[model samples]
Target: MPALDLPFSLLDRSRTRAGEPDAVAVRATVERAHRAEGLGYSRFWVAEHHAVPGIASGSPAVLAAAVAARTHRIRVGSGGVMLPNHVPLVVAEQFAVLESLYPGRIDLGLGRSLGFSAPVREALRTARTDPEKFLRDVAEVRAYLQGRGPVTARPAVAQAPPMFVLASGAGLTLAARAGLPVVVGGPVLRGPAPLAPYRAAFDDGPAAPAHPYVIVSANVMVAATRGAAEELLLPDAWAMAASRATGAYPPLEEAAAVRRRSLTPKQRESVEQFYDQAIYGSPDEVVAELADLVRRTGADEVMLTTSTYDRDELARADAAIARLFTA
Candidate 1:
């Protein structure tokens, strides 16, 4: 078998499980980050979501700081921080504090998304929806990080931590033009249209590297058998389909309980589609598929985002995936 040579990282959304308190999910994420460090995973990133019951990580910088405090060596970051929800200076200071305390082990990945829904967006006081504002905000963030603006960000460091832009299509072009690395996944990874433009637009000047950096995010689960793997994936898949059919994104239920519930025809189709697209299998099968993903997408790194009902099984899957690169 070919070695799993591409770098791999963990992206934890801090998914809340059915019947468990949200606090448990948050704490579990930090614990998982510690485990990831010991398992030889490169980076552990937390995501931000608001007005969503299923996700507890509403503040990435705060969670990243918590993870950084617990782990000795693994890089901790936002998978990323949604820029529109935050004041640029505030975002700058929060990360500056993280960098001040943790030094070289922090990453700041920024995205232009307005929270999740219109109500959430309104609650966030998102003033700008224009795409051009995203560019402006990204520039402003870079400025604040480097203390280039009239008001210097507090606890100014000698350097800004490496920055990443999470985007696709035109967003990728914007990232490349700014010389920042772009993280791509979802629909963009499923097709070939977006990446070529990203590479073509890339200049790789002093602001970023000479070559483009691509990170692919995927829903991955691994178990001793294919059936077990599918079972592990079902809870999150069901929650997603439920969210689509009705706007409520509930916490994940147990696999057995989720399987017992009958889905609407539309929801059933959504669930099956999600199951079909996810990467899951025994160790050998997963390793082959993951390598092929890297080959097809030209990903510099692979970021695994797995949500499961069973904590023990989740840890086992994490360990199994880590071994592909380590063993």
Candidate 2:
């Protein structure tokens, strides 16, 4: 509830670990999400990334249950579940069970990307299709939840919680048309351009709220020293930037190591530029920036993800951001 006052949600992973060596980090991250519920965070979302050992959120629905079991009040859902790989009925059934157990604390954020490499894509054995197919799955998901889809799956639609499309491109428009709420996924790293696209195309449909429902996810990291905060966050920013540029999932390389790697001139430039959009600074500095983000984007919420892996740091970050209003 406090995060709602500040309107910050927690984006976490259930299965994916950042640094290698395997099993330990994966479990630790899930435990971290469960513990984060005690903090003043809103929804807790796990993303769907496959074949990347570094990615722990591959089965978001399953992870949602694990997180929900451990925590009491905070909402739990997928930051995104890539919709291209599976059948609609299956998702409907799986989440149906989840919604039944957890009730109101469920969110389903869907994405259209494959979320894996070509080889991993083949291993999933899913057929690649047109973008429109993504919409069909959405419709099917909506129909099931609204209790209108076919009865063959015997899906408990009416009992299912809520679902939203997690999109980077025109996903807001599709969500707007469907009258479902949407959270603008990805770092506001691209800044207002990505945010603008989602807002410009939002439609006022039957289920539409009078105001737009936009929660821009922020890659914010704050600490005592601006340099310290940036240092803590650089690894993630560097990793994310690398993945975007190469479409190759790499381990969470140290920022310096990543910088020294075989980066083209343009790639180096991109990595530097991406940080400009993220909130990485001291508590005082971050408050000024974070407040401006909400005011500028008209985003109803901001999901903070970066170095939340450290509890003391996270508590300080929360306190600092909260001070803006209290002061």
Candidate 3:
């Protein structure tokens, strides 16, 4: 397959597998980052998911520090740290410390998502999802990171790490007004219509880039055959379906195990819907589809968040996908 013209990255949520400790999943994420650096991926991002059973990464800043320590060249950051669950000053300080340690290799991707469930939200001290509050928090975090906030964030560095907004509807407007780049996926990637306004409305202020930038996030998998690639996606798809049906996201099971279990009509439909949104195929097919996606969306980068029960298979898929971006 021909190399993709633009950069590509990986976003690992430190997905846990059945019968494994959460520590193992965290370690796997670090190891994957080390491999990602060697494979020539532009960046390796971790995610934040509070009180989620399937995802072991509750703190992206902590995970990003671990990843940065292990990897030499790959950019390390959050795919995002949800702003609603954090204090702006504290969030800025945490990422400032990371940037101080990692220097030019750190990134801070911010999002507006709250915790997964009501209990989780309460545990996070996040009562409601406020878009305006999120916008203010994002700005405050950026200000602190840039040394422009009222009080200085300690261990301050000469430069702030680049921030990307994980955006959607109001998020696009917020990012545009803030003049920050955006990372969008799901329905936003279905067509170019959603992004056109964002591009048109971009501020491009002194704190922002000269132009609008977009990073497209997607669940991508690759293998020797289309069937094998599709199989790798089943674990996550099944977990998502179960989560939708039962409200508890369980650790990923082996694809074979997932296939053997029977599902209710709603659960089955959920699984199929998950599959419909993901891109899984042989290398050539994935390259073509991703190329088409990039062409349509005008994405500056593609962030893959593919997860499977088998660590070995996931590593191989990562290497194969990396080859499509590297020479």
Worst 10 residues of 1 by lDDT: 185-194
lDDT of 3 by residue, 1-327 (tens): 688988999999999999999999999999999998998899999999988889899999999999999998999999898988888999999989998898999999999888878898889998887778877888899889889999999878799999999988878998998899999888754555388889999998787889999999999999888888888899999999999866768999998999899888998999888877888898899999899889888889999998999999999999988888854
lDDT of each: 0.85, 0.67, 0.89
Q: Estimate each model's TM-score.
A: 0.95, 0.84, 0.97
Model 3, runs deviating above 4 Å: 189-193
**Pairs clashing in candidate 2?**
3-7, 15-56, 16-55, 16-56
Q: Which scores higher on TM-score, 2 or 3?
A: 3
lDDT of 1 by residue, 237-304 (tens): 99989889656578989989987898889989989878766889988888887887788877888889
lDDT of 2 by residue, 1-327 (tens): 122245667776532324556555456556666666656567788777777755555788887888888888888888777778778877777788888888888888777777457787888776574567787787787667667778544546455566766655666667766556677645544456456656556665644445457777777776777888777666666666667766754556555665567867776666676677678787667777777777676777777665433445555665554444321
lDDT of model 3, residue 320: 87
Task: Give the clashing pairs for model 1.
Answer: none
Q: Give the top-scoring candidate (TM-score).
A: 3
Candidate 3 scores a C-alpha RMSD against the true structure in Å of 1.2
Please provide the root mean square deviation of candidate 2 (C-alpha atoms, Å).
3.6
